[model samples]
Target: MKYPLFITQHGELKRESNSLVFSGELIKKAIPLAQISEIHCLARVSLTSGAIDILSEKSIPVHFYTTKGDYKGSFINDASPRGKLHLKQAEHYLNPEKRAYIAQQMVQGIQNNMAFTLSRWGINPVKLNSISVEGSSMEELMGIEAQLWNLYYAYFGEVLGVKDFKRTRRPPEDEINALISYGNGVVYGLALSSVLKAGLDPSIGFLHEPSEKRYSLALDIADVFKPLYVFSTIKALIKNKVMKRSDFSRNKNSVYLSREGKRKFLEALTDTLRRTVYYKPWRRSMSYRFMMDYEARRLVRHLKGKSKYKAFKPWWR
Candidate 1:
């Protein structure tokens, strides 16, 4: 299958018949429609109205990114007629009990994966009620998820070998947080594309609150993958000294990957996505890139009542 493409330079995207053309000061590329699943504009990338129209017609998702690698928003095609799947999703949403169940599962999946990552380093998370989602209300569930993240970040210093690596956003205060912001953008972009590919509504979510422009479902789904896809990759890059303090720059109250650093991080992330994993049940190997789409299909199966939904959490068995 075609893959998601990342555009990291100042460029203009235009429609060229059946292909998409990206024109940059240093290079130009025209990718055929058949060879692309989605496009993420990482920096100063503008698009023509024709490009937007054609992209929508083709049902390809496009996401915009800020310079620091935060997800700005996405332009998704107006979904074509949903046969029955969306109706089922709405039913789940309107029912408080069902929605809470899915939300709890999502939090459980993320916490379990976080614990797995910690286990890989032979480090145990300081015991906290961080993994349980058996909350009495939606507010309580959200509070539990938030608390787990604090507990999760507590180990960043030990695991990533970066000192004082607290989670920071808006303007990331340090190098690792900056990398994470960028890495999270990557995760969200890929998640959004895969959700679109599976014909799922990105706005209607389980764990995260649905809002005006945010793809909450993508955020919710991405939680399960970020530890493996983003954090592990970050750990590798830092431990290998491939990324250093020199790769980052400080702005007013924020740190961001320099253009060169952004290039380095994206290259590493692309390599991570292409890395193969052995899917035991199928007894075949698939790239990490495929997992996003796989999860989308799994969610569909659960929604259709063919099976119970189980979020994939990478762990050593």
Candidate 2:
């Protein structure tokens, strides 16, 4: 099975015949080009021009990050298509009908995600009086989202390992929040890589409007998968003592992932996605990457009118 390549070492990447090699101080090896979905160069990493050419030919984007774990910029050889897609999104946003359609899709995606998560714990969330999907329009969907947020937090104290972890929104003010956010970022990167491979326009999304530097569709899709991918991983990691309170930093204002914490968190999340899990919607088992790619393909179908787009429903059986 293919894997997302995380190049954490400071090195220069080169495209050798049929494979890619990373060589520099403290790093030397050939990466399997076929298996790499995306190349995440964390901290200081250099890439040769040949490596860029190979990755561009495969439509693989190299994501760069600063030493502080902040995102730098994505390297892609082509820019025209992304530019045109951005224009399309601006036009859609200007039209009321198109904007409404996109808003509905985003809400549907989040709603489906919440419903699926609740069902896993044998809870019928759709029947909850606290949660009501009133009205039929996009505006009403926001109301549904607010209700789901309440319901989601209510279950935090009940979920296995997290029962003891306090629930807080915004920056999560606690150790648990830091772990969750770190894991969520990993899942987002994984989903983004899959979306790129599917040839979908990540910048033109159904839920998130076009932005100057953000990929909104990736964020939308990541929302549906985060509870499944990130939350699940955190549960396992905490249960197994793979993470500790030292993995985070907190001030009165906010809590955040430490550098070492993020490294371990991403490592755990990557392993979780690599492990095959049975998905009820698909019947047969599939990897997390395959599920992400499938969702991207579904979006393309929605665009082509080949099939109606159904936001991914998290499965539990």
Candidate 3:
């Protein structure tokens, strides 16, 4: 089984003894039960009481939205944190030196991910031209980091067949922006899930500020994997022509995804993660979903000090 989404249209979901069946005038097909992690209702849809109970039992989250794709909210069956571990996490955050240590770890994670990315493309890991490395200082590390991400976006353009694509600034102004935002959203969700599984306080993060609404820790961790998850999908979409310029709409200063565009983007993202990726750190490569779960375990290990904290390096070289 794989990750699945159960989208509801004009019908209600009902649970049978062994299966979930949809009933209504516009009951769409049910996705495979084992593969489903989420059920997104794009329309005003109903669910039988029995179906709700079953969904809760399965630990699947249901997200509701209007017909026009306005996000209403999500129904999560399990949202608890590990109370004991969360206390320790809070204590760590309150101490200045401890926070700085964690911050150093966070930076290391980012650097390691950059190293991994450069290694993937067979690019030189260190900036030889910039400085003679006595084994790589912070400045040389930053230089290499900049170069790796530039190459990452270059790969994005090549993958998507967008000859004129540029790496976007914040708030996203074009089709590329829409894909980037959607991909980052997926990354955040996956990271949040990982944080929850690790028993960490998602609001308290090493690399990101705690003042924001988002789980800062999740955002920090998401940065490590966002390029791989989102950029790669954009490339695939372009290669298959699953999406086109017509799928986007421009207002004064920003571009937004049309309904069809959102559907296609989500489909591409799901498919991309399900595709197997070879990760050298893990002797046997796994799917993106498994990679996400592995990151959660990594965070746990970092807190417990069983393994050193390292960020994801891009698979570019």
Candidate 4:
């Protein structure tokens, strides 16, 4: 099965015939192009032109992240372009009522997933029920979403036994914040891959307004799944006492995961995505990764008026 390839060491990626090889100081590995769903470079990895050509030919996306785990950008090959679907997607964005509906649904999904996850963690998030999704304007809707997340963060910190936890970004102020920032970036990259596979413009989003060099639609979709995948992984790691203090490093006031830390986290995250769960629409089990792609396709169907779009709400295991 194809899986995401993560490069955590500084290396050079070269195309060796039909396979891609990573050459670093202490490690050398070759991966068949057929076995990779996506590539994420979390370190300073240089790609050869030949490698780029093959990846483009295969329509494989390569996501780049800074040393601090901030999403820099992505190299995506637009192999399939559905012009008609693009028009329908833009039409939905152009219509205020349609845009509002989609945005509300996305927020509702985020809320539901957040509450469900919290409950599973033995934290009853009754406060999320008080927040209303029937906001008339985009600002009001966004405000409600922000409020929900704030409450979530508070509960998340409490359950994790992290005192006075606050969400900080860029240069994360604490270890948990660093993990959240990095995990969210990974989720966003996965969502962007799904949007590209669905042939949708990632920049055009319903909840998040389109901005330069930003895949806002992926951000909107990623929000729904963050609680399910990202936070869940973190919780498991903490509960199992798998992550050590040495896994993190501090530079002045900022804290970030060390190289070993990323490897451990990514391993856990991959397992989370790979686990199969029952999907009601399909009436069968599906991986979390597949569910993300399916969610994007469902949005496309909604844009084409073939069906009403519903955000994914997994059956908690």
Candidate 5:
């Protein structure tokens, strides 16, 4: 199976035949086109237009992130040029009723996944009952999700061996918050690549209103997987002693991971993607990465009216 390629160093990516060659101070490596399903640049990385052409031709999306693992944007070659799928997607967004339904589904998915995570860690997810998606307004849904996540994250502090923690951003105030900020970026890159594979217009979304250079569809998808893929992985890493406080560096109030810390997180993320889980409908196991692309295709079917949209829920072991 093909895997997403992540470059965590300051490197130059160039095209070499049907492959990508990376030249950097510490490492010079070549990656065949077939082995790379997607690409994520985690730090200062440069790519030539020739390399971009190759990736575009292959329909592979490349996501760019800051050295701090904040999402910058993505290079997704527009392969779906105002086709039938795009029309349906636009129609759904334009119709307030349809848009509201999808928004509800997205929030429901996120809340359900959060509850599942808490349950798996032996916490009572019943606290999520305080929030609901019964209203029409997007504000209600967003508010409900926020409240539910507050409870969910409260449990995360216990599972990850942290205390009295609150999720913060904009130069994360603490190490835990810094890790979450970084991990969310990881999941967003995965979501965008999946959207590209499904030929969906990431800008036109069901939940978030489309904004300049913001892939709102990816934002919607990332919400569902964050609890399962990103947060779960972080919890396991810290709880199992794979990562420790020394991995992070704090300058004043700004908390960030060092290069070695970044490498360890990426390696753990790779393992999380490769790990298999039972897919209830298929009754077979698939990797987390494959499931993400499959979910994107499922969304396309839902938009086409061929099937109803269903959120991905963890079938815990």
Candidate 6:
């Protein structure tokens, strides 16, 4: 099965025959092109022109992150563009009522998954009774989302026994925040891959305003899955004490996962993505990774007027 290729070492990637080869100071490895779903460079990794050619030809994205795991950008090859579908997607964004509906559903999905996840962890989530989207402005909806996440963070810290588990970014202040930042970056890349697969313009978003500097649509979609994927991975790691103190490094007040810590987190996340859960629509088990793609397709169907868009909740829900 194709899996995301994570380059954690400073290396140079080159195309050797039909495979991609990574050569570093102490290590060299060749990977079959077909086995890679996407490429993520968490370290300084340079891609040769030939490697770029094949990757673009294969329509695979290469995401880059800083040493602190902050997303820099991506090299995306849009090999296929659905012109009509894109126009429809833009229409949803342009129409205030339609944009409000999609944004509300996305937030609702985040709230439901947060509650369900907390309950599964033996914590009672705070009820969000005040979040009604009807006749609500975009700012109000965004404020509600902020409120929900703040509650989630409180519960998350409480359950994990992390003192003051506040959310921080741009070099997270605490260990929990560090893990969250890194994990969210990974999920953002995955969400972008899903969006591209559905042929949707990643820059056109409903919840987050579209900006030329970032793919805001991926950010919108990533929020829905972060509670399920990123938080769960952090919880498991902390609960089992899988990460060691050496797995982290500190630079003044900012904390970051060491290279070892990143590998551990990625391994656990890969397993989580591979684990199958029953999908009600298909009546069969599907991987979380597959579900991400399906979630994007659901939006496409909604835009095409084939069906109404509802954010993905757990099958049990």
User: Which candidate's lDDT is highest?
Assistant: 4
lDDT of 1 by residue, 63-148 (tens): 89887677887788855756587878778888998888788778877787788777777787756433556554788888888887
TM-score of each: 0.86, 0.79, 0.73, 0.92, 0.90, 0.90
What ranges in model 1 sit over 4 Å off? 14-21, 30-35, 46-58, 73-75, 126-130, 133-139, 315-317
Q: In candidate 2, which residue pairs get closer than 3 Å at backbone N, Cα or C atoms, i.e. clash?
A: none
User: What lDDT score goes with residue 235 in model 4?
Assistant: 92
lDDT score for candidate 5 against the true structure: 0.82
Error of 2 at 169 (Å): 6.7
Quote the RMSD, in angstroms, for model 1: 3.0
Model 4 regions lying over 4 Å from their true place: 134-136
Q: Best candidate, TM-score-wise?
A: 4
Q: How would you encode candidate 4's per-residue C-alpha lDDT over 90-147 as one tens digit per residue?
A: 9999999999989988998899889888988888788887787865578898898899
Model 3, 1-317: lDDT tens digits are: 34646353467788777677766574446546787756667546787887878777887767666533444566666655477667766776787665555655555555455445444445555542232222443445445445656755665554455696776744467778767875666567666656655667778876566865677888767777775566667766776778877788877777777766877877787786787766676666677766666776776676666776555444523
* C-alpha lDDT of residue 307 in model 4: 91
CA displacement after TM-score superposition, residue 45 of candidate 2 (Å): 2.1
lDDT value, residue 185 of candidate 3: 64
Clashing pairs in 6: none
RMSD of each: 3.0, 3.8, 5.0, 2.0, 2.3, 2.3
Off by over 4 Å in 3: 1-13, 21-27, 38-48, 63-72, 79-81, 96-98, 101-171, 278-285, 314-317
Cα distance off (Å), candidate 2, residue 171 = 4.6
lDDT of 6: 0.85
C-alpha lDDT of all candidate models, in order: 0.80, 0.67, 0.64, 0.86, 0.82, 0.85
Residue 76, model 3: lDDT of: 64
- Residue-level error in angstroms, candidate 1, position 133: 4.1
lDDT of 6 by residue, 1-317 (tens): 46677788899988998777899767999977786778888889998998898889998889888876667888888888689998999999999989999998898888877887888899866554345545667889899989989989988988998777788888688788889989998898888888887999898989989888778999999999998889888998888889998988999999999999998998888877777777666778877777778889999999999999986778663
lDDT of 4 at 206: 97
